[model samples]
Structure formats: C-alpha cells, structure tokens
Target: MAFTNEQIAVLEGAIASGILTVRYADRTVTYQSLKEMRITLRQMRGEMAAQVPGRPRARRTIRLYQSGSGNV
Candidate 1:
C-alpha cells in the first residue's frame, strides 16, 4: 500500500521513538532496534522517492541558417 505524507511522518516519528513493528494486512515487521528501523526506513524512502513521477522535459527546436544559399 502507498503511504501518504502524514502516514510517512507518523512512521518516522514512531521509528524515532524506537517503535519498530509495523503491521499491514496480516503481516508484521519487527526491527531489532532503532538503527535497523532507520536503515529499513531509509531504503523504503529511497524506493518511494524513486517511484515518484518527474516533470516532462521540454522539446527543443533547432534552427539552421544558411549563408547565401537559396537551395529548395
């Protein structure tokens, strides 16, 4: 499931507070300590960040001018 900004904030807070176990559906993930949780969170955040859509690039038009050339 995708996490909202608020939810991600809450998760970050919980990790800071040493609360590791996260439940989703019928599954649970428990980290050994805040350090482990931080590492996991960093990985998750990196993956999520990579998944975000970026702005489309603008198209460039190149104009070539010929000097004293009137060739059709």
Candidate 2:
C-alpha cells in the first residue's frame, strides 16, 4: 500500500491530465487531483479490509445445562 516518491509523482501527473480514475463495479469516480486520489484509495482499501471475514469467536466456558439438568 506504500508508494515510492517517483511513483507518486507519476500518478500525480496522470491525475492532473485526467488519465487516472477510480472504478468500482457499479460506478466510476473522478478525483480532483492526485492527493485526493491517494486519500480516496487509502480509504477504499481500509473499507475493503474491514469487510473481510474476521476471526471466529472464542468458545464459551459456561454451559446452559449441567449434569443433565435444565437449569444451571
């Protein structure tokens, strides 16, 4: 997710010339400038990562039924 200074400069040029755009399945986004694009990309990446499945829940120690009885 990190970009070198040279790469950033190149992207900045492309953005200034309207060559770079953010595209999703349903729509496209045009950034005002490279700085905005970088910010937007970072936010999008965070959102995508957050949507990924997380670790399973830990097992519970307490049981509802004990010694075949209905109540604890």
Candidate 3:
C-alpha cells in the first residue's frame, strides 16, 4: 500500500513523543515496542520514496583497475 506524507508525519510524531501507540487519521495502532516503530518508520519512508518521485535511487558499483609496477 502507498503511504501518504500525513501518515509518515503521524508516525514520526509518535516516535518523537516516545509513544508506542499511534493514532492515525481514522485508526489507532499499537506498536509492539519503540524499536518496532522505528523499523516501521524506516520502511514507511522508503516506501514513500519509492512511490513518489525526486528520490535518489541507490546504486551499487564496483570498478577494478590495475597499475604497472616499475613499468612491468
């Protein structure tokens, strides 16, 4: 499911407030713990970025180069 900025804001607020129970627009969710909430928040942010645009995509790259020693 796509997440809205409002939802993210709500979750962030709960985390900042150090509360586990988050009351969203029309729903109230009780997290198992602060750690879980944090994890969810991260996921939410990632998902939001993926859903929206202007977010930089992560890329993994590797370059190999060899240099001659003593003109060998």
Candidate 4:
C-alpha cells in the first residue's frame, strides 16, 4: 500500500517523537529519538489495520532487556 504525503508526515512526526526505532547492526537506532519506536510501531499498525481488511489486529506492548541480553 502507498502512504500519502500527509500520512508519511505523520509517521515521520511520530518517529521524531520517540515512538519507534529502526534496528540495524544489532543496535537499536531510533528514527527520530530513542523513545519513539513504540509510538511509530503503534501508528503503523493502526494504519495497516485500516487499510487491510479481515486481518487480525494486535495491541502494542513494550519488551525490555537488560545488558547482555541474548537470543535463544
């Protein structure tokens, strides 16, 4: 699906406000700020839900890890 300019702007703003983080190189990198990753993900999920019919929607939650966290 294509996002409009306005929608993109809103997403960008959310990212800037610390609502989402795009990860790369095994490190968390915020699109706008450290805390915005969650917010952006929420917004994106909402947008996706609205555009896609008959799909299950899920709520957003935070998962925290201490230093030296490892994947199973």
lDDT per residue as tens, model 4, 1-72: 543445555556655664564443354544655445556556656776677888766768999878764675
Q: How close is candidate 3 to the true structure, as a TM-score?
A: 0.72
- Per-residue error for 5 in candidate 2, Å, reads 24
CA shift of 43, model 4, Å: 0.5
Instruction: For model 1, give the RMSD to the true fold.
Output: 11.7
lDDT of 3 by residue, 1-72 (tens): 778899999999988999889988788999999999999989998888787677778788999888777474
Which candidate tops lDDT?
A: 3
Regions of candidate 1 where Cα sits further than 4 Å from its true position: 1-10, 55-72
Clashes of each: 0, 0, 0, 10
Alpha-carbon deviation at 36 in model 2, angstroms? 0.3
Q: Is candidate 1 or candidate 2 better by lDDT?
A: 1
Taking all chains together, each candidate's TM-score versus the true structure is 0.53, 0.40, 0.72, 0.31
User: Model 1, range 34-54, lDDT digits (tens) per residue?
Assistant: 887777677667656766789
The deviation in Å at residue 19 for candidate 1 is 1.7
Pairs that collide, model 4: 18-35, 18-36, 19-36, 19-37, 19-38, 19-39, 19-40, 20-36, 20-37, 21-37
- What residue runs in model 2 are displaced by over 4 Å at the alpha carbon? 1-28, 55-72
The candidate, 3 or 4, that scores higher on lDDT is 3
**lDDT by residue for model 2 (1-72), tens:** 433444445545556676767444455656676678778556555554555688444456965654665676
